[model samples]
Target chain A: MKETLLPSSIKNKEKRSAVHAKLKQQKKVEKKRNQKVREAAEKKALELGEDPPPKKTPRTIENTRELDETVCKPDDEELFAGNDADEFSSILKQECIPKILITTSRFHSSRGPDFIEDLRSIIPNAHYYKRGTYDLKKIVEYAKKKDFTSVIVVHTNRREPDALLIIGIPNGPTAHFKLSKLVLRKDIKNHGNPTSHQPELVLNNFTTRLGHRVGRLIQSLFPQDPHFNGRRVVTFHNQRDFVFFRHHRYIFETKESKTPEGKDKKENKAARPGKVVARLQECGPRFTLKLTSLQNGTFDTQGGEYEWVHKPEMDTSRRRFFL
Target chain B: MPRTTTVESPGCPPLRALTFDSLGLVKVIEAHDGQDGGAVKMVERWGDPDSSKCVLAASILDRESDPLVSVARKCGSIEVISAINGDLRAQIPNHGDEDDAITGLHLFSKQQSESSSRACKLFTCTTKGHARMESIELGGTVAEFVRDPSPTVWDVCGSGNILCSKIDGNENYALFGGKGVEVNLWDLQKCVKIWTAKCPPKNTLGIFTPTWFTSATFLSKDDHRKFVAGTNSHQVRLYDISAQRRPVISVDFRETPIKAVCEDIDGNTIYIGNGSGDLASIDMRTGKLLGCFIGKCSGGIKSIARHPQLPVIASCGLDSYLRIWDIQSRQLLSAVFLKQHLTSVVFDSHFRKEVPVPEVTNTVEEAEVIETPAKRKKGFKDEHTSKKKKSKRSSKKRLSDDED
Candidate 1:
């Protein structure tokens, strides 16, 4: 057996254990004294018919630590709870026409005039505003006066139209997108006639981290409340993280009348009379957007590295839309 | 140790203001005049010197009469100490729960009766959205507790949602901000909420929410119904309870979140401080950035207090330095290292005569001497000796100024 070198080792276990026992006894005595003092205070308070003073909780250093952790966790269900899909979809019944005002930066290249003309062909209701005093407040004021639902601001950097900032009227959920490819309607010669139907909006494969931001930006670009007179129906769908966008016309039509059977006649007699029913009809001029890449905080459609996957087949009635 | 030796030999000016920091130390500093850096003397130090209980908020009560400094600690204990002697007058334990740190301390006077004198009421709010009002009699008896109902919306956030505010003249109104909740004006007299301005929805896509307000102040004496808030979103928002529910004015100031905000005496200018140590003055009417005050503040500023009758503002924060800046010139006048992270500062506005005028010639000579490297090396030793003599002479002069 090895000899214990230290004085406070197991060789002197009895002494060490005795010291520990002494400490334990002292602690017990202290605790009892504290309890007695507290009881005495409480009894005195009771005699006086007053509440005893609240006990002082011991101070801890953790109290000074920063408490905010809600900003990082976006998946918190409570934050997403109030977003009612029905309430949002109800906007389609209110605003159908998408009247847009196009305003480019004052310091743009010669290509700006030609681009504006091309945009007018694609969006017939779009109006061009000569950029003069490019202040956000002034621009918003002008757009309000013109009664435009959305204001599209084309920002130029180094003589290149590199970004598009879209702000909805009245109150904003503003969206900024990167402009790329610069393809005009005339450049795609094989493309069908412009007057054949309404432009189809196709938003494709915007699913990555950067893609989600772009997708949300595009979604907010549309007005929160739709104009029913415009007969516009905007669709946003995501499948396996690939978001898709389409804009089409929708009209409400009265369903055809049919003679009631014996069981239906009994139910009809019990129910209130004269309820008008309408069915939704989807129409033409669809726009398609294929989001290929994101650069400089904007959606870029020209990047060729985008991985194209076959569109998933599903019943339209059974499919759920993301936005 | 002799009291005079400990108190007087440091050659610092007399104390005109008191502040408490997160280290649980209370320091009494001399107030600065409008020109530049003034003398800061730690005349009396109190509380747990080892910093066992971090001081969260502090306010000086009855500055015009019986001056008392009330400090709220992180452990939910509130201690009132004398401003002159640092004697503990009253200690209330468990004023709030341990998990809920006190966020603000406001002192207001309320008339108790027709025959009795006015009593000082201390209103405190905790991170847990608990608000309590306690009436303290002249004899240091603390009683008459009034607590507001816990805001149900903030229940899930717990201590993450902190509330801070300033009390109105009669202690009848409190304007406070809650994280991700709303800015609410409460009627403390009736213990009811008056109105609420909901926080704007964040613009981020499913992540990176905007920060809540860290500090706020009423716009001015003329418009008590409106207030300005410095938010973690790096924006200054002005809300008028009389107007619409949304903010009346919103302007982005900087990239870093704003930590402190105060309105100027005229109410047309707003002073703001950010977490990155940038202090700026903004024109409230035009919404234009006036200028930034350059200082040696490496850490975030926690509190900003302007002089009652001067163009100077004093600020203290994590850098452990109390800095005085001239709002007109945008120059740092003085910086005093207190060796503790300061959380709150309150000026003794009643002690008006204690302010010291800036010594222009002395600073100009020092600047010139620093420019010449050859002369600086030779004058370094002489400068130290002269500085000590000047400090002694200035201390005597400061005493005379106080007499005036």
Candidate 2:
């Protein structure tokens, strides 16, 4: 269109930087000639059988959220009898085993004991402690008198570790979170150490009801049988409410290239020639969490009972959310 | 009259309520006149999800002609049931051989008996301080094996714990409170105690503040000497008992532990909730606060009720849902969920009043067009009078709280 009136009436010193690099090379050749005429009209409308164009959807705030009538309806028998009577239902029915404890927030720093030693090697029977001058309600009454079925804490601030808490033990629902992008395990990249077995988890979306009680308080911090031959795992995922975490380990391999480049080349010749693929690896200590406040027992920051708190006017709406 | 014909269905105003949870289930919700998320209905569960039959204190006798409810549990019995078809009817053992626990149940009515029957009672209390009562009866114009099951117990506050009670409004005096216990009161026809409170001083860092009390009530409707309570540290307080035994107001709110307080039938507001799902509403004659109640209740509100002629309010807790709200636009007019943790709710108030009452007069004309013209200019400076006494004395001074 006359190069948008020829680069602002070519007013500059070096002739308007050569007409703004010739109008950005004529708008990258008119956007690759309009993407090769929309891929030759979608390959001549699939060789003329017609109907090949309806693809656009991308408006994501997790597919425009804001409807949430407490979601969780996969055959909700009163949300499975309220998760078979909560408080992590006796370590989720394995009839009790959790343990955890972990600690930190009391003027602690050095990357908060290296992120609670990478969350005590990704939470199994966890342990850690040393938050010296006590008082997280006295380490939740000394981890509920040592039977500690979860406590966590972490917290730090300038040297990083930014906040975590958890709690649960001896009648509690605690939670708290907010920690952020950490990385640890010697800053990742090909990382992979984990193992004393237990890992497995996964979790993902957690669909509402306060993301299923913060996904059963992060599934009562591990251990209810998950040694999957230690191929480790540990996910948490939960998209729009933040969570994320990660860690991995799988293996399988075999399929190196059967035409796997990009655009479906006829669905890559329907793969299968020596298939196997799996792979994964990155077992570092990445992080994210978000929650902010769940409380209900245990660590009483002066009276405890909050079953959900995170407010800034509950973020008004960018597709509102609350895990 | 074909059940007085009404069902005007457009959605929003047919509530019913009844809750009670922590596993010994009980549900009942309802919501009809069309919808807006309703239908809960479990109606009876009672323990054995592998022990700890929880249900720590319930209540709902809705001035019975049949309804009933009671609950109590944590091993100390009480039961009752019947709110229409959930049956059971009686039980009553309480403080079950003494390991203590029940923490307040309530019911109340006790008066009829000249063989025409009626009676009522229940009460309960516990977490060590005990308190009992019992009666029930109901049957009337004769025969259910000549009724009378007997219960009595009433040691009232022989020691601490107590958790919370209430009674008042002419049921003569009850109050209680808990944790390190403080607010006392008692005298439900001579069960004793009478007035106690006291604590509050120290803090210029001199520490002191601890006398727990997690939830108490009675602010008005026949006073019994004022009171309010809440605490476990999120404070609230109020008290009075004919002027100062301590808390003549106090305040705090919002670090959690208030767990349900209620008050407002124009008793100078109150509400509370806390333990985190924060419900708010304060005032109690200027100790102030007020706003909160919009949506957020993931759990911990344990029971709020309010609707003795609907301005709404329901609540429930530990996030098993139930909600309701609309105390003049404190909003959230309907929620439901009902999975478990609940712990007590109530409000049946002749629910669909003989089938509808024109969907409760079209929800009092959609709560008077969703209220808020600065609360209809602080109670009718003449919106042409009698909209039922200006919506019942401008929705009788509001306040409510939950999360226990």
Candidate 3:
């Protein structure tokens, strides 16, 4: 009746590969024919005043994520009330300007300072301090006395910048993040230089309660009033609980049309003239951050209470995300 | 594999608890297991509007009358509110400045209060060793709240901050411990020190272990001499005053310091939660770790309270979620996100007073999984004989080693 033996079952290797390739090509042609037939059917149905077939959505980790109860809902009175009294409320309300003090761990690495230098260029009113055998607790005390609103500590291991600690001033809710995939400004191609004006902050995919708190913490590192004229933007995009940091500058450009040698280009231009398009040129220093722990108070490892701790067991499901 | 229990099972009631947040917000949470998953919700909320006046410590005084919640503010003020309605029953203004914040608040009834059985005394202690006790009665038909009279104040002789203070079941002794402070047991009747925990000897590095006790609790409900204290160095020390001044058994937990410790109703087991959200149960008899509780908490556990009757415990923390866990299964039963960093939590034993028969029957049925009385008796007998034989063998081995 039909040849039941498959190409993979062929005894000769050369013959098996040849048959396999031929079968693949035949299958490709068949798929195209079936796609055409389906499209024609859909087109004919539309022309006959009938609805087209429904679109099939592709399955993805984000779309098929487990249901999370902590996802923030709009018009939640309790969440709003809690946010109003949070530690970053003053900075978020624009009542106080955020003055950040950035430093590295006790043992310094070459790349750590370079990363801090790039960070200083991005954050306004940020000053870098050299860590020289000074205890973090002592530095926190000093920063509090000096009226610094926040402290950022970069920790390096094996000559690579690995961890970041951000502590809110006076009172705290310290956050520790594992940093990776760092690309400096000089390494990125076609990267633009950042302007002195405060860049606008965009937090994306921060839907859960913990994500909202982390978003607010990152937001407090920058000034509340942004200069739109600068066209510079800093975005913290969270996907699968990894926060990707990106800086970009945007520009508006006019759309251009291409015409055939003998075609009438005027008709194409008359339909839509000067269609404007926005383009972004990235300013470098790209990185990814995964939160490790969130402490309730300042960076006191011995006694401070952590609000959340990342453990190996927490990664039970690939689709389960905290942020 | 965790079974989510439902309150729909005729006589089973939902777990009711009170939680306090960092901004002085108090919420009453109710939770039950549903077919789909655990369903937890906040039923009531009330607290000081001034966010600066953070809540430090809180306790629920549940007696024959309506339960009262005592919330101690960071500014040293204590507010007593009706647990049922969140109505302020009494407000005691700040006793001292902000630095002298209240560290402990305990409410207990005195034996001499038989004349006014509803009257309970509130014990409050501050970081500066100031202790005060005031009688408060919330049983009256008065429309307006009455102000409490002047309290009897004393000083606890301690060198450093008294971070925690807890009273024994009989209300005869109070245990005080804190940063740089050793565990001290004081007789509530005489107000004199009964026992003091000695400092542990030096370690291998010739360094003395710091005496910073973050949390302490009694090993048993009635035994004041057997105490368990957790230190800031991630060590849990069990002390039996009748045995020795030093700890009989000391075990190290995970890296982070232990923030909260609670004894199980069984008295042989203790649940200790550390700053890093690790909740583990240890058998106090042998100081061996039992399995850790399932369902990890995201934040440092601040308070753990065992239900007076149920085989469950409720724990809340800076993560702001109130979680109820079944003690026998060591599995999380239900969790409610409170939306604020919770500072403390307490179970409402008298949440619904309509039915008592079903609850009494439930305790026995649930305990069947662990063991029945007859089964336990046979097992105990076997264990006793085995233990005696093992002790004799160990002594003989010790003697041989000594001779060699």
- What are the lDDT figures for the candidates, one per model? 0.58, 0.72, 0.81
Clashing pairs in 3: A307-B299, A308-B298
> Quality of candidate 2's docking, in CAPRI categories?
incorrect
The model with the greatest TM-score is: 3
Off by over 4 Å in 3: A1-38, A45-54, A256-273, B1-13, B31-40, B47-50, B139-150, B352-404
| Model 1 per-residue lDDT tens digits across residues B50-103 | 344678888876444346778888778887766655666666687435687788
> What's model 1's lDDT at A282?
34
lDDT of candidate 3 over B1-404, digit per residue (tens): 22234233121236678888877888888654442344557877886445666789998876423577888987677888767667676777886676888888987744355785446688888887787777766433223344457777778854788988888888888888988789888887787888888999999999997789999999989787898999999999999989998999999998988989999777878989888888888999999998787675778888899888788888888777788887777877777787777789888775542223367766664355123211111222344454654443433343343233
Model 2 lDDT per residue over B230-307, tens place: 887787878787887988888887676787898878888879887667787878888888698867565678778798
Candidate 1 vs candidate 3: the lDDT winner is 3
TM-score of each: 0.45, 0.33, 0.84
- Give the alpha carbon lDDT tens digit for every residue of A1-323 in model 3: 22566987789999899888888998999999988988998999899989988766867888878678889999887788778888899999999999999999988777888899899989999999988899999999999999999999999988789999999998868999999999988889999999998999999999988899889999999999999999999999999999999999999998867778535678778787767899999997999999999888788987788888898887777777899
Using lDDT, rank the candidates from best to worst. Answer: 3, 2, 1
Model 1 Cα interface RMS deviation (Å): 24.7
Best candidate per DockQ, number?
A: 3
Name the TM-score of candidate 1: 0.45
CA lDDT of A312 in candidate 3?
Answer: 87
Local error of candidate 3 at B356, Å? 14
